[model samples]
Target: MTPPISRSHPGLRAVFELAEFLDHGQKLPEQSRSLLAQALQECIADGFDTSLFTALGITQWGGVPAVKKIGLLRRDRVLRRLRSRIPEWASLSPNAAAKEMSASFRRYETTRWPRERHSAKGPAAQPNSIWWGLLRSELGVPGEKRLAQILKAEIQDGFEFPKGPATVAGTGEHPENTGTNIR
Candidate 1:
């Protein structure tokens, strides 16, 4: 029988690192995951050179395939985007980043899903989505207070509201209006 591969193998090491990243909830965003999946399928159909696999430390015996490598690269790109968007990520250690990402994921889930079972009907009722009913039981917050806490923390931690359009009263035709009208 062939000798068992050691954990010291580069391919194995990379896989372990990826597993740790996933365990920490550092997953790629839905859009990025979809795009990367399509790209990987295309790459497989195109048939990459064996040398490419060799360069990535993948062998015929056992190692990450080209598709997985592509996926990992795409995930890394998403992680980079996350780091850029959250300034705190730049200074945080790996464990801290993981904790932050987990909290962010919880907040995202709370916002994306409805909090009430009966409030799944109609547009306003299903504020998150019309299909919220289907997934309501799967992802509802225990209470509004938890969501409020998450929002408060996010706002205090550098989340900024989008800027509104500038209102120049004199420059516009409505000179008397001063552009301060709420309507």
Candidate 2:
């Protein structure tokens, strides 16, 4: 007998579906696009979908929850301005700063078009770097680093990047494109 689908199944499934769609670099077909959009939104409403981000392999920023608007800000003036304040914002209580950061990251995920949300370049990848920049800017520590500082006691962990599995393999810079950080 088949096992029941886990709550994260839809979100995880959406992650790959969207990636494949974007990888094709062709026009987003309406039918497939709508289906993917529903899956992604449902993933949020239904349950925690950490597995979805994991599949995207955007771990460079540590553990920032993957969000679309922030992901799409690649080189945008608005994002740059906000990011420039990392030093200032990071100075606040780490918990408070992180809470706000997560909110900011999530703010536009649902509203942006699925295709544009995933669009970005290698260097401009936001999920991880933004998280790291905020922490590094101020006294606060990003979740990844905080957890890492205590590695002797315990140990580690990813988000939205455009140049996913296919582009990485094509780079040919490495003998094998095995790392999770897609950019």
Candidate 3:
């Protein structure tokens, strides 16, 4: 039998370890988690968001300061973007309404990175230990394009827009359900 190709990098292993702990609701070793937290804080301070933490693939079982900083940075960027892009209704606009809406959107977008990045990265980003037999059967083909198509289909069918709000309804358990509550 041939050995399977391992696409994950060594640098990503620590990130994956952190991700696994988060996925399993387990706490990471204090030292390792702390380091990740520090890195995360620096990333946010440098203008990255919590979503970047998720993009680098760590969320649960990391440092609190990092996570909060990520959130705050994201909120700041989003509000800046919104205020710049959206025109004021001047006298009639609600106080800080745009900022509030932008903050909510930022939170939602940042929270979505975990699942979205997973899908976006394609099978190439998945760990080697994952059974290709099962994954291939479920996703069809092992190439990048196939993976992207699969994710796009899942994203389109999996989540729905909420009534009266921009929020999505439902948890992201099903392939067709891209909405997650882990924010």
Candidate 4:
């Protein structure tokens, strides 16, 4: 028999975090929110069925949920921007888009939360070079392309690509892909 599912998937966690932020009357920082909105749009363009309202546990009336109408509006704005900014994005396959998005998330996470390293003397303090580097890299790809590039890199460096369509399922063991290197 299949094991019981765990809702610990990265995508699910992102959705939950967004939902919790909204629920707590806190606004998502613009950059993070835009990243998420673009990711959703990429999934949609790639023919992946995505319902932000449902993912965030908000009930939809007609088509849009009223509770998070503002966020939905922002998402719609971001979607339009993505379509206009990335001419070839609409033609990308679901698998390809998912792969790109995974890469983007991985990069964003690393930059946003750099790991603290400890030394024999003490914890090594360093400026956020990762975040700065990502910022500089974004200059090469204007608008949404930067996000796409980041997402596409998500599965590199021995990271395993999703075996099927995107879902909030656990990423099973990928012995071949396990490593400390970030690609």
Better of 1 and 4 by lDDT: 1
Compare the candidates by TM-score and give the number of the best one: 1
Tell me, what's the RMSD of every candidate?
17.4, 15.1, 20.6, 18.6
lDDT for 150 in candidate 4 is: 40
Model 3 per-residue lDDT tens digits across residues 15-39: 4456446444556667657667777
Clashes of 3: 2
**What TM-score would each prediction reach against the true structure?**
0.28, 0.24, 0.26, 0.23
Candidate lDDT values, in order? 0.37, 0.36, 0.34, 0.36
Writing each residue's lDDT as its tens digit, candidate 2 over 46-153 gives 574533344333322323334432222221221223333566543545445445555554442333323343333222344433332322222222343342222222
How much is the lDDT of residue 36 in candidate 2?
61
Residue 10 displacement in candidate 2 (angstroms): 36
Q: List the residue pairs that clash in candidate 3.
A: 158-176, 158-177
TM-score of 4: 0.23
Q: Write the per-residue lDDT of candidate 4 for residues 1-183, one digit (tens) a residue.
A: 333222343333455456446434446656547657877776587676645544433334335443343333222222323333344544675345534434553565465434422211211111122222223223211234644444343332221122421111112211122211111
Judged by lDDT relative to the true structure, which candidate is superior, 2 or 3? 2
> Model 3 residue 25 lDDT?
52
Model 1, residue 12: distance off in Å is 17
TM-score preference between candidates 1 and 3, better one: 1
lDDT for predicted candidate 2 compared with the true structure: 0.36
